[model samples]
Target: MKSTVEHLSPTRVRINVEVPFDELKPDFDRAYKKIAQQVRIPGFRPGKAPARILEARIGRGPVLDEVVNNAIPAKYQEAVVSSEDVKPISQPDIEVTEIADGERLAFTAEVDVRPEIELPELEGLAVEVDETEVTEEQVTEQLDQLRARFGTLSGVERAAQTGDFVQIDLSAAVDGKEIEEATTTGFSYEVGQGGLIDGIDEALEGMSADEEKTFTSKLVAGEYAERDAEITVKVTAVKERHLPDADDEFAQLASEFDTLEELQENLRERLGQSKRMEQATQARDRLLDKLVEGAEVPLPESVVQGEVDNRLHDAVHAFDHDEERFAEFLAAQDKTREQFDTESREEAEKAVRYRLVLDALADREEISVNDQELTERILYQAQQYGMAPEQFVQQIQQAGQIPAIYQDVRRSKALINAVRSVSVTLPGGEAVDLSDLLGPEDDAEADEAPDTVEGEVTGESAESTESAESGADTADSTEGTAADAKA
Candidate 1:
């Protein structure tokens, strides 16, 4: 067997391969065995029929076809791995060029590949993030939130005011025709919370039980959408929330703490930790932007198109793939079809460039994802999707997405490494340190590299082919910690 590569472009290549007939012994045997089981010979039972006899009965064409089909994939993989410089990122387009009965087999495969990238010096990377500090007002707001959780609502025979809860019946009419979808009864709402509809809060204000007010507002949906409609809200009951006094007894009931001061201090510390994680997130994003913008990356058109198509597919699916509905959505967003296309293309190009830069950085730093790190990532993802770890693992395995997940983890570590190398500062020029948020850097993790392309440490994809989404979990955990602090 022999192979040679031809450079089609910086991001693609074509490989030509040829194999002698003697090299196909194993493939031929497997093909013959498989075919013999499917076809019954005169004297032989099941797969016991000899290859030559089977070939004679079925003719040489079918056997040769089977052999070629089975051999192409394995041989193509052989050709690719043999070439050290050829790192394919996409599936190959394979074409069999020749099939001389006994002489040799020849074929060609075209694929997209990663181009050599020149990385910027990591030490020179710098970014600025907001200073993180917990304010007294923020702590007080959190404390009030805790108090509100333990508050009780009591019935009151008075006009509803701000912060009061009310149960009401609502009816809407457009041009003297009642809108059934917009009418409801026994709906409970909080005054001043808003968001139910335009002009609702004002209509409900200063109204007592058994009192009704009719107000005109514009509807956003249904046959009378965007048209003026009259809404009548009848207040069925009025109630106000009453809170327990902020005292030592209240603190003990709300949490393990026995004093109000200790609770406030705990809330302040929680808020401070949340602020630090926010700083870490800001630094990671700004640093990534700085690094990617400074580097020159050659984008693959196929990869970019794949990403753009994925986005478009998702966008259209939301509107049931109806052209008019999609148009309305774009119009609502104040975007034209041409503008959407251009933006999607631009976003896809940026995503491809980001992944390429991070992959190069990972290569330069000899980054590898340890089992512990990978398991932690899986657990985090499982929690996010609200599935048990084993269930999530099974789903991903059936879909053959484990490699994609592995690539994402690898890219995240690469981005984190870049964040570690860069400088972060506040607006006032004070240096910001986020080691406490990002966790400590391990020397062995930094030094280790996957010894093989498909090794357990590396997982798969010797060279990653896509962008990563990470660092958002930093904010999520911070929020969880803040909630825990409240408890």
Candidate 2:
């Protein structure tokens, strides 16, 4: 067997391969066996017919078709593995060129290959991040939240208003006909919470006990979704929450702290830690932006288009691929289909670029994921999707998505390594040290970005949030390539 490569672009190549008939012995044996099992030959047991006999009965065309189909994939993989220059990032476009019967077989595979990227110097790459500070307002907000949890409700002798709890009866009618699904009696609701309907807040406010108000609101679900319905609400009672005073006594009851001042300080410390994590995340993002900007990554049109198609497929899948329903969804969000397509294309380009950049970094650094690291990442993502680790493993394995997730974890470790080498500072030029939060390079890693479909740029790629939400992106089935679903 022999192979040659033709450079189609900076990101794609065409491989020409030729195999002498002798190399295809294993493929022929398998193909003949498979075919024989499916067809009956008189006087021969099932699957026991010889290749020559099967060919005589079934004709050469069928046998050759089976052999060619089985051999191409293996030969293509062989050709790629033997070539030092080829690193395919996308599936190959295969075309069988010739079949000199009893002599040789030839074919060509055109695929998207990773470009030769001269990455920018990553050592001590400087980036600016925000200063970590916990404001008094933030502390106060935390204290108030704690207070609300321990608060008690008391019946109020006044009209329902914002923050007041109301016991009310609600019923709605579309075109004057009753909607049973939209009707409830003695439902407890907090005024101004505003999840029930659009106009409920305004209607509930200023209504005293035993008072009723009729208004119209658009129904959001059920049989009358998006339709305006006449709604009637009768207030049975109004109650207001009485929160404990923010004093030493309240501090003692709410937390282990003995004083309000102590409680406030604790909140401030926790917030500061949270802010430091934010700074680490921000630094990672900014450094990625810096590196990608400095690197020369020519986009692969085929890979970009594939990413775009996947995004569009997911976007419409929620509506069961019904264009009309999808349009309605877009309309609700004030986005047109053209705008969505344009944005998707733009995102696809960024995602592909990010993947290429991180891949290059991983290679340069010789980044490799151990089984333990891969398992940890898998477990984290499984929790993110609310599935047990075993279940998630089974799903990805069934879908042949292990490579996609493995790549994601590798990319994450690459980004973390980059973060450690880069310099981070505050807006005022003061150096910000994030070693504790980001962990040491030897012990640190995350799996949440392009995190692609890339579980991609905006969500997965370049977005490494190690502290707050660092679980990387969701893994889709690996793209089709040299091996189907293993690209």
TM-score of 2: 0.87
Query: Which stretches of candidate 2 lie above 4 Å from their native place?
Result: 168-187, 194-196, 210-234, 444-487
Candidate 1 lDDT tens digits, 97-155: 99987989999999776678888798877889887787888988898889989999999
Clash pairs detected, candidate 1: none
lDDT of 2: 0.76
Give residue 59's error in model 2 in angstroms: 1.4
TM-score of each: 0.81, 0.87
Which regions of candidate 1 fall more than 4 Å away from where they truly are? 157-162, 168-187, 194-235, 443-487
**69: Cα error in model 2, Å:** 0.9
How much is 440 displaced in model 2, in angstroms?
2.1
Poorest 10 consecutive residues of model 2 by lDDT? Answer: 465-474
Number of the top TM-score candidate: 2
| lDDT of every model, 2 decimals | 0.72, 0.76
